[model samples]
Target: MKQAQIICPVCEIKISTLELPQGKNAHCPRCDTQLYRGSHKPLRDNLFLALTGLLFLIPCLFFPFVTIRLFNINFSANLVSGSYALMKESSVILGFIVLFCSVLTPLIVFGTVITAHWGLTRQHFTIFKYSLLIFQRLKHWMMLDVFLLGIAIAFFKLSEYATITPKMGLACIFLTQIVTIFLLSRLSVSRYWQRWQSSEQFQFDDVQTHCHHCHLSQPESQSCVRCGFIIHKRKPNSIQKTWAFLITAAILILPANLLYISIFYSNGKRYEDTIFSGVISFVKSGMPEIAFIIFVASIAVPIAKIIGLIYILIGIQFKHVTDYTRRMKIYLFVKWIGKWSILDLYVIAITIALVDRDQILDFLPGPAAIAFAGVVILTMLAAESLDPRLIWDDSASNTPQKESLHEK
Candidate 1:
């Protein structure tokens, strides 16, 4: 293979490609950010995997995800019903967000992946372009893995009260998650571009500018020639938008954790649980493991995200450019863990769907669910609004006058 020129999205360090064995990625020498990893699998294999995952995921909505049995009462819940149940319990916004994150995003991503591969197979670059772009933009929002974890936590928490059994839908979703994650891990933007170039002369290698959305290097233009997403040196209005989101999230985090998040009724006795109280309940019930998970997801992650984001923002504002590696790690960690914070919402959605207003046992969404949802969403938006490249840019120069958010 011939050497190719590539620019690191983080530091803009132009690097010459080197031949590396399969399964290893080339990293930026300056910031250690991954720059390239060639996918070994053919597009056909990815197409088949995506199709398999979609087929499994579709049936998951119709079939029972889990069954609950308690004294003349039996009920089942699946993805669709869980969202509906959440909406009926007055947490409509949170319910819709959960539905979007778990169901719609994954479906679109997989569908796009298959179509993109189909386009590539047919040499239809137009179809390939749009589908691949959509896949790139939406893949991060897919939370099937977190949804699966929520399933386990819900089962453990509810087992103390009722007989809970996994159903075929659960099995299907599990397989879907595994397949999707594996496919995503193997999927890399550069591999497709290389494949395209091999078929014909392509301009990808000549350009040094990188698309953050797709991570594809192309000739500098208003939009990415490959993915069609708008291109920029760094995310537009990165710092200002991040601070706005973080401040809003910081305000909501307090109410989100302190107020009641869920209500349960068992044989005419009403019980309510806040984020902390719920975790404590799990510990009291001899499930400290589950308690810890809940604490981390529902309580710790949200706060940590806010504080971490604030730390990054303050560092940038003060031009604290030292510890580039530490700041970069904080940025990536915040982004990676932000979505997992929504795990509790899924648990609540599933539990309320399965046991909501059942006379024998029931669950209801409390006021805090919405607040908590806001906390999660805002923090995620905050993380996304931040440009990781900003850390490197700050390290290179502390020039405050260039590229001001106010300058247009």
Candidate 2:
């Protein structure tokens, strides 16, 4: 029997699927776009990690994440308190966004993954399929990694004026991030889907066209049969759309840095600070690690992302296809870290919520917070708009390969 095949979503080239060796990935021979990766570990192992991460989340919610003492006054915050504080302070939308991304989404993702794994083990096909679908949707919203970076920024900012201490919940959050990353790396959903299909003796039709969004196989059509999203060989004007978002983000990064992020008031003194000021404060306070993180996430990452997107867009526009693999890796890295740029805004939200008193000590949100959030969101959209398969399309012809490796 002929092996199954999938068309590259970005390049629209039909390629045979390969059963990747353990810890290996099959890239398109022409464009070097990663088609699929093999998981070195079993699905059960990923299940365990997901469960472990879920357990760690308990401490992250209840226990103190950080403590700050200023002028003999001490205040501690947990994950829940920040959201509640923001809501209480009338920033309802911001509050919900923080809570959903930091707490609710992570819980949902792990829960869904756990359910899917259980269904897989028990051969509950319906439960497994639906659970996996939900998991795929929730995974993008789980921002614990971004939340942890926010915590680091909060610590650095607080340390500059108060006696700051990392609490047990903070440690737990870090560990949860580690386990989540590990679980995601080991659990290849595509591979598991293929396995389930094999066990069920389900076969996809030999169709040249497939939906990029839903992965639905169908005859050549203009829209996805399942999703109703307009189907295209590649994203419509992918390069132009990416460039627009990237340029917009690049333009916003300046005011995001130059304008004040937050203003602090204490004992009749006022201090307004930008992102760089916070980094400098941390460094001067002997917390070089915190400074480095803030600098990278706030400064380096955003600039690097804009520049990286520009490089990729330029390469695609001009048909300069050298180092396709390296550029693809860069694109992946940019996509992965794009959300972390929101850490500074998150820190401000949490801090504003915590330190809002009349006289003693208080912080006010600044104009830059909105600008910074815009930068993060725009870059994320840019990453989503730019298809990685386009990187390969520049060098390779549109012909579909017939004799590609088969998925096992």
Could you give the C-alpha RMSD of every candidate to the true structure, in order shown? Answer: 5.2, 4.1
- RMSD in angstroms, candidate 2? 4.1
User: Taking the tens digit of each residue's C-alpha lDDT, what string does model 2 give over 1-408?
Assistant: 135677765556677665556666666555455566655566777778888998999888889878777677777888888778767764665577678878888888888888887887788877777777777666766788888777766765666568887789888988988988887666666656655553124355666776654464556788855445677867788888888898898889999999988788887688888999988887888889988888998899999999999888888778885777678878989988887787776787668755776566887767787678778878988988887877877655667665473343
Q: Which candidate is the best by TM-score?
A: 1
Candidates' TM-scores? Answer: 0.91, 0.80
> How many residue pairs clash per model?
0, 1
lDDT of the candidates, in the order given: 0.81, 0.75
Query: For candidate 2, which ten residues in a row score worst on lDDT?
Result: 194-203
**Span of 10 residues, lowest total lDDT, candidate 1:** 399-408
Which residue pairs overlap in candidate 2's backbone? 17-405
Candidate 2 TM-score to native? 0.80
Which structure among the candidates has the greatest lDDT?
A: 1
CA shift of 148, model 1, Å = 1.7
Give per-residue CA lDDT, model 1, range 122-227, as digits (tens): 9998888788778877888999899999999989988877899789999999999999988898787666765665412444636657877556666778987655
